[model samples]
Structures are given as structure tokens and as C-alpha cells.
Target: MGKVVVVGDRYTVSLFKLIGTEGLVLDDPLNLETTLIKLKKREDIDLILVANDLYNPVKEKVESLVIEQKKPLVTVIPTPFSQGQPLDVKGLILRALGFG
Candidate 1:
């Protein structure tokens, strides 16, 4: 089971690396498709960290996956974006699952 999974671009690498250094094993830093595919196969993942900028590029597709999979997804906005506040993507994921 994955303790935490972070999905984002190179810009968020440091932050996620810090997160990984703390003890979590993140998925490979590769194409989003591969990551999503792996995520789909893993039943142990409980949380997803999606960077704001990267999320925008794949928002529709990611949303579709989240809807189909119905898991807990968290959105992490970059410092320069979203006014530097962390919005709990869990809420969005919950809403998508009709549980919010």
C-alpha cells in the first residue's frame, strides 16, 4: 500500500522529494499516463497529490479517472499559483464521488 503518491511536474520535484525523503515512496517521475495507469492498478494508494499547473494540462482526463476510480485525490497548488494556499483536493474528489 502506498503511503502517499505525488503527481506533478518538475517544478514540484524538490517539494515532493522532501516528502519522499520523509518516508513515502512516490511513483516514478515519468509521463502522467504511466503514473495514472500504475495508480489504477494499485489498490493500496489512499492519497494523490496533484500539482496545480500539471493538473490543468490533464484536468479533464484526471477528473475522469478520479470519477471512475473514486479515490482520495489532493490538489497542491504551487507557491506562485492559487495565492499560495493549499486547497484540500479531498473535497473536490469527495464531491466528484457524490460524497461531499
Candidate 2:
């Protein structure tokens, strides 16, 4: 029903944008908190894809929003430099269902 968005570093943003994903590329980590807070308030955003590296720094804040607001599903995704790993689809489902 709502739009999906991505928030990450320049490389991550560029890669997703190439595939036609809409998002914001954060140039500075200092602004990550404020940027995420703003995105959380948007009624049009149904999901948010955050780079794993970036998400680690703001995990607490992000998780709190995910649990409390329960909208705009926030997910941490692997970055280009990370080793290949299988996605935990089951875990994500549980989290989305408020069971994780």
C-alpha cells in the first residue's frame, strides 16, 4: 500500500537506485539518526532497507521504532563488501509478526 525506501551509504544507494529502488544516500553517519527519525514519520513509507553497517550503529533506535510504531518495516541488508550469507527469511517473518 505504501512505498518502499532504502537508506544507506553512497555505494549502496547507487546500486539499489540502478535497480530502480527509491532511497536516500547518507553522506555522513552523524546525520543517520535524524534522517531515520524523519523517515519513520512518513505515512507513505511501508518498508525501509538499511545497510548492515549503517544499521549497526543505530540498532537501538531503529529497533525501538520497529517495536513501538510497528510500521515501515525496517530491515538490515548486507553491503557489497560483506561475505555472502543466506537471508534469514524466517527470522524476518517472526520479527514482522512481533514475535522476535
Candidate 3:
């Protein structure tokens, strides 16, 4: 697999760790533009996981960039207290990426 960058709040970062990504997880709540700029530069980053309480504005800005740059995207809901629970939404992303 490729590097996975988790973009969201701190709690989501913890869940990202549980997802077992071999790549780095960036805790980017505020500086999304800079984080995405850096992500765009990193050719090694193959997938992005976007978790948000509501709609993620950053997602709208970067989904096109992901397409233009040719990287896969995974969107998920970040439940505050459901870390260990299985996530069907995550399965949707994995299935779309052909990893499930």
C-alpha cells in the first residue's frame, strides 16, 4: 500500500492509527491548505482519508486536486466514541479503492 494521510481533528488521528496505515498521519485541523499543499508535493502519498463532523470544506477544495494528481480518496464519518467498532463507510472507501 501507499502512504495514507488522515486529515481531520485530533480524535480522528487516533482512529487513523487504529486503521493500521504504514504511512504518516497528519493532524491537520487548521492549516488544511498548507497540509494539502505538502500532500500534493509528496508523490509517495497514494491515499487520503478525510473525516469530519460535518461537511469538510477542505475535501471540496482537494478532491479535484486528488483527481488531477491521480491519487485515491477515502471519506469517512468520525464517530467520537466508536473507535473499535467496525465501519461500513470505511469499507465503502476500501471497496472503491479495490482494497476491500
Candidate 4:
């Protein structure tokens, strides 16, 4: 069994830490590559939750690691600021049907 990790910006990292999750807060984009490389090499980490905003920049590198190593599972998650509200499926259906 391996540990779960989260990597993202300061706000996302802080939010995960508040919930007692282990994570890395990337303050600079320049360090993104190095940080990801290190994480990929870590045998202890199984799942990696990356912020959607940050994932786009290093997506290729992350995908390569996933394909080659096949160790850590990387997933992109919406940032706190962007996760304002859940989608209203019922409202969307009604609007699509011209009944709302």
C-alpha cells in the first residue's frame, strides 16, 4: 500500500493540509517539472491529486510518467475558487426541454 499525495498551488495545498492530507504547494511554475519528477520517483506515493490549473502546464510530462512507470495515479481536480457550486442536472434537463 502506498500513500496519497496532492500537488497544487498554495491555496489548494493549504486546503488539503487543513483536512490532514499530505501535499506539496508549488509556488513557482519553474519548479513544476522538478517537483513532478521527484514525485514520480517516489515509491511511497500511489495517488496524486493535481489541481486542474496546474496540471495543464505539466500534463505531457505527467502522462509520460504514467505510461512508463505506471505507479502513481494522477488525477486533476477543480480548484477551490473554481468549485463554486455543483451542476444542476435537473435544471439543465428542463432548460434543454424548454420547460423551465
Return the top candidate by lDDT: 2
Model 2 ranges with Cα > 4 A deviation: 86-100
Q: Which segments of candidate 1 are over 4 A away from where they belong?
A: 21-30, 72-100
lDDT of each: 0.53, 0.71, 0.57, 0.67
Model 2, 13-73: lDDT tens digits are 7876765567798866557678778988999877777777777776776667545656777
Angstrom error at residue 21, model 1: 6.6
- Candidate 4 pairs with clashing backbones: none
Q: What is the C-alpha RMSD of each candidate to the true structure, in Å?
A: 6.1, 4.7, 4.5, 9.5
Candidate 4 Cα errors over 4 Å, as ranges:
60-62, 66-69, 83-100
Residue lDDT tens for model 3, 1-100: 5677666666666666676653334454445556656776766666766565422556675556545655645444554644556556467557756789
TM-score of each: 0.54, 0.72, 0.59, 0.67
Cα lDDT tens digits for candidate 4, 16-97: 6765568898866556667767888888877677776776676776666545655676656677666556534335334433
Deviation of model 3 at 50, angstroms: 2.1
State which candidate, 1 or 3, has the greater lDDT. Answer: 3
Cα RMSD, model 3? 4.5
| Candidate closer to the true structure by TM-score (higher is better), 1 or 4 | 4
Worst 10 residues of 1 by lDDT: 21-30
The TM-score that candidate 4 achieves is: 0.67
- The candidate 2 region of ten consecutive residues with least summed lDDT is 88-97
Return the lDDT, model 2, position 68: 64
Ranking of all candidate structures by their lDDT, best first: 2, 4, 3, 1
